[model samples]
Target: MSTFYDCLLTGTFVFPLLGSLVLALSYGRLSERASATVGVASIGLAALCTLWVGFAFVDQGKAAQTLTLWHWISVGDFQPTVGLMLDGLSMTMLGVITGVGFFIHLFAAWYMRGEEGITRFFCHMNLFVFSMILLVLGDNLLLLYFGWEGVGLCSYLLIGYYYRTPANGWAAFKAFVITRTGDVFLAIGMFLLFTQLGSLNIQTLLARAPEWWSDGGLMPQLTALMLLGGAVGKSAQLPLQTWLADAMAGPTPVSALIHAATMVTAGVYLIARMNGIFLMAPDVLLLVGIVGAVTLVIAGFAALAQTDIKRVLAYSTMSQIGYMFLALGIGAFDAAIFHLMIHAFFKALLFLSAGSVIVCTHHEQDMRKLGGLWKKLPLTYAGFVVGGAALAALPLVTAGFYSKDAILVSALVSGHDVLMLAGLLGALLTSVYTMRLILGTFHGAPKSDHAREAEAGKGLVHGLPLIVLIVMSTAIGAQIHPPLDEVLPPSVHGEGFGVDLVEGVAMIVAVGGVLFALWLFTRQRGLVRRAVADPRGARLWQFWHNAWGFDALYDWLFVRPYRELVRVNRGDWINTICNVAPWLARLSHDGLRRTQTGRLRHYAFSMVLGSTLLLLFLLVG
Candidate 1:
């Protein structure tokens, strides 16, 4: 049984890696069907492995297990092994990555049919799955960092998959650079841990953290702050979150995989996995909640102003991740992981459904240009309604309701009344924007030729994943929360009238947001348009549309100054100094080439001269 478990653990990541290699080696040789089959089957197999291993682990009483494959690094008293850990935390992550990732891969097979570079697409997708699996299952921080950078690389490659577009390239670069900023902080944190504690093994480092640094001490706060830096960056939390909406430049499958299932959730996974270190750093933990609360409100507002369907979902992704961060911040690790899993289901569904809409409408993604698509694309409409309900956290029926309610409840029970209020407000914003997206895209008459002539996708590949995801986006999916009691710090469940009151308020806010949006879009549509056409209203819309002008502010504060510095230093003394060796080498090369004349006399003369010079030097010595 142990050996079988090890094999399953190893196979979960290996299968996708092997598929990636196969697709890469057979690039352009395999048909689209062949590539898709390999990609989908690989992740599907991994997903099966995850389920088997998960159930077996639970059946065996849910104790944490570790499998050491081999020693990875060795130095003076510093050795880290290539090992896998299977606790409830990692098990939950495995299910999310493989389970949701498999569906995304399957949907891509249909969405990417007849597209250029299909083999390359599958190869990158497979590699992404492998990287995310490596990230969540690694036993040590070093191995986890390897997977961390791997996902960043894959995101860049996939985001710029359409290399023909300069904008896509820039978007990919933006995401890579911004995330790297956070990764550097993570790297520094690792360095500090190893220097002070003499280890990078996660479990060891965490167990020793309390002994090394007392609670609320400078060291603990600094380390936790560094970790938070990385988490916020990867999870698309504030200040570093400007890249996500632009990342919609990638194919919809890439968005679903990266934004919905894997990359964005990595931060939540990190914080949750290291709950011990965080428990000691109370200030940093509270800051985590604050960042989350503020970000959710900010992202919700931004989502409200988005015109692009995928961009709207992108902002919503940021908002949803904020909720996870909120859970993490408030010491509700279980709720965070639970929401992470549930968000994976519904967000992936929404993105895939949007992909269906995009493909059917001739790749038009602007909600303003899409309308009357409900009947033409009933499957997609159903997806939108179901997924949007979950996104909006609509009452008790949606999967999001359970997970999200857990977060708000945690905020209230933790005495973070302000954060709880922010959460409710964000919930209202989420519902409003989600309904705006639905009504603006599908409810009105066809807004353009694309929508008017749209055709729904046919095939099991197209419909099966959506059907599965729709089911998962409901209360049925909420019932399958991982047994996290052993892995994460137990959440404080508030009882009595206050808990019920909070839940009631949350429910009302969610339903009310949806209803308000319905009324505004259906009845006060002209009033809304005219108000937006007003000067002040237009500015507010523009401000929110531009994500509160963060990108512009960043350009002014960082990008512009850097560019100016580079321009000013283009020919500085340092450049001249660095160029000296190359300049001399180039001069010597030219002089030597001149001596290499194609004439026998020239060769003989050069040889004689060289001999004479050598003889003179020898005589002098």
Candidate 2:
């Protein structure tokens, strides 16, 4: 018999899946309240189980624990089991997924009150949590891939939850198709890893990789690059990043839980989990850092151009993931995970708080039209400022400062001075965009009736989550420990942190970014408007507004070519074979129809003649 602890670790993923099944099977029969109850209870129980295992793991100081659930797949020499592992890395992710996840569910219960398709919404949300849990806890790479795509599938469903809107469905498809582009690369990489290593079992691979594979091998570099493709798609890194901003069509909870807090962070976790493999390929590691640096700066520029509140948050998510990627590039796996934790808190808080404001304003999302809401929606204002400050990494008292600073410090001292400069520029943007979001929406005078009506629709469920995440955003960093570098490799972290010239420079840049945002977006809003109205300025505005024309580029390059090919082929080569049988049948039937034109006498004559012919042919043969 298995102990509760073993089941508990696995249950953190399974229970939500079970809840999803229940909601799906009983769809439409349950009321909104009932669906919310089941959804909250399912994740709530998962959170409790996480707490249990966390305490035990800490108290006992266990190295790692693997629960063999059952045999999953077998084919002669290839066998992968259904199992769950609890180590420092996975344990931390579990705490984040279940703990922060539970609050998101709670907030959703209230945020989506009386909305249509509530059951369907919760079902997809619960399933997303399950998939994310599987992603973090799975014992093997194949199973992790299952979890990885599961989150992608759930994201599509949730984003298209409001199918009445044509834009929503398009957004969902965009997210699905773009991410799948990366998945193809991941599948190929997995095939190569299995072929070379002879196993996808993570533990075995991690343990035996160094012995079996030489350093600086082409195969390893190729595999790392492919896996990086998968990470880029899921985490919204550059080139594959245009999908996330449009994904704002989903519910606020979906945006918070999937796009911001949990799912988008999967790329960082994947790289961190496979830290051993990446360490062997120095070139690949450097590439990861460069991609992260460029993405952070690009995404920050995109966020600065956004007008919709959620789109700003979406771009913010991409930028933050870039920071985590930079940390991975610098070989600071622990710092990556640390920033991931803090980012989750503040980003989720920001999204949930945005949802509350949206609910009061009757779903208006344009920040230009939303202003002076801080006075009416005090709780939401407080939550937004707290979360934004964390995002900005305000000198002290914010969680983002501790975690993001750790990454900045690591980058500075890692002998890659150029990347350190890139890191500083990105941090400045982070602070700038965060302040832009606050001042444009909350600091200016009320521009519309909706902005003035921000305080009416408030609930305890909504307030509870905002308060919890606000507290987390402010304090979670001070308490964050380094990720499990003991199990993972090439963390490149040093002991004891202190302030120095580099740190001083980073803080000054962050503060300057914040001050500039206030001056340009708040006090000098008119001047900013006049600048944007000019032809050159407007061109830049439109450029960033459309995500650097990536969508248009993909449409022209990929979508149009495939569509034109389909049109040109018309029936295609396979369809030629399909046409032959139909044409032959039509010819035979036409001849037969001419003979059957008259009557019963003609049919009788034909049958007699056919019998005579059959006898003659059989005898001759």
Candidate 3:
């Protein structure tokens, strides 16, 4: 039985990796259908294996298990194993990665049809799945970081899949550099753990952390703060969040995979996985809550001003992740994971549905050019409604309400009143922007020729994934919960505010925001136009539209200064010093060329002369 469990767990990640290898090797040789089949089938098989493992884990009562495949490193007291762990937390991540990833892969078949480099696309996608799986399942920090860096590499490749486009390449580069900054912080934190606690094995380090830092001093605080820095960058929280809106340069499937199932959620997983270390550093944890609150509100406002459909969703992804971070900050780890799972469903649905609309409109993604799509694309329209409602946390019907309400209630019970109010404000902003997105894309008359001639996607490949996701974005999917009580800290539940009052207030705020957006966009659009026409309103819109000028601020602070330094020193003494080795190599090559005469006589003379000199020198010695 143990062997069977081990094989299932191993195969869950291996299948996708194997598929990636086969697709990568067979690039340009395989048919499009063959590539798609391999990509989808690999994740499909992974999903099946995950289901088997998940059911077994739950049925057996959420017992934590570990399988050390082999030793990774051994140097005296420092040894970390190549290990895999199966527990409630990993189980939840497995289900999200494989299950949502499978549907995204399936939908990509239809979305990417007739596009160039189909095999390469599938190769990157499969590799991404494998990396995220390793990240969640690895038992040691070293193995987890291996997967973490692998994910960054795959994200770069996948984001710049359209390599001919310079803008996409830059976007990929930005994401790579920004995320690596965080990875460095994470590496430093790991080094501190190994130096202080003497283990890189996660469970061991976590067990030993309390013994070493039970007093909540500087060392634990510094380590936790460093880990939070890594999380902030990877999760697209404040300051590091400028990369994500540009990340929409990737294909829609890549966005769905990254935003919903894999990359953005990695930080949440890290914090939750290392809850023990964080508990000792109370100040850092509070900072985590502040970061989430600030990021969510900022992202929500930025989302409101987006003209591009995908960009709106991109900012929405950031804001939603902020909610997860908020849950983590307030010690509601289970609520955070629950929301992560729920967000995976609805966000994937939203992205794929948006992809469908993009395809139907001949690649037109500007919401300004889209309208009256509901009648023409009923299935896609239904997907957006359900997915958007879930995103907005619409009352009792959507999965998001249950999960997000859990976070909010946890906040109130934990006595973080300001953060709770920030969450509420974020919820209001979420509803308003989500409604505006829906209305701007589907409600009004056709705004351009693309919308007028838009063709709804056809066949099962297009419809099946959306249908499945729509179901998962509802209350029905909310019923299926991760058995996380044993894995994470239990959610904070007490008597600060009546749970009913909180729910009712949250419900009203959410519905009111949607209604307010409806009236503004639908009934009083002229007033909206007039407001934008005003200079002050226009300036405010532009400010929010540019994501509060973060990109520009970063450009001024880092990019411009670095470029200026390079320009000034382009031909300085440093360049001369750097060129010395190359100059010597060139001189030696010229001298050697003179001796390499293209004649047998010259070669023979040189060899004989060299041999005589060698013999003379040896005799003298």
Per residue, candidate 3 scores C-alpha lDDT tens digits across 286-384 of 889899999999999999999999999999999999998898999999999999999999999999999999999999999999999999999999999
Q: Which prediction has the highest TM-score against the true structure?
A: 3
Report the Cα lDDT for candidate 2: 0.87
Kindly report which residue pairs in candidate 3 clash with one another: none
**Which run of 10 residues does model 3 get worst, by summed lDDT?**
492-501
Off by over 4 Å in 3: 495-497, 568-575, 594-601, 615-621
Model 1 residue 447 CA deviation (Å) reads 0.8
RMSD of 3: 1.5
In model 1, what is the error at residue 387, expressed in angstroms? 0.3
Better of 1 and 2 by lDDT: 1
* Clashing pairs for predicted structure model 1, backbone only: none
Residue runs of model 1 more than 4 Å from their true location after superposition: 595-621
- Indicate the worst ten consecutive residues by lDDT in candidate 2: 490-499
| Selected candidate, larger TM-score, 2 vs 3 | 3
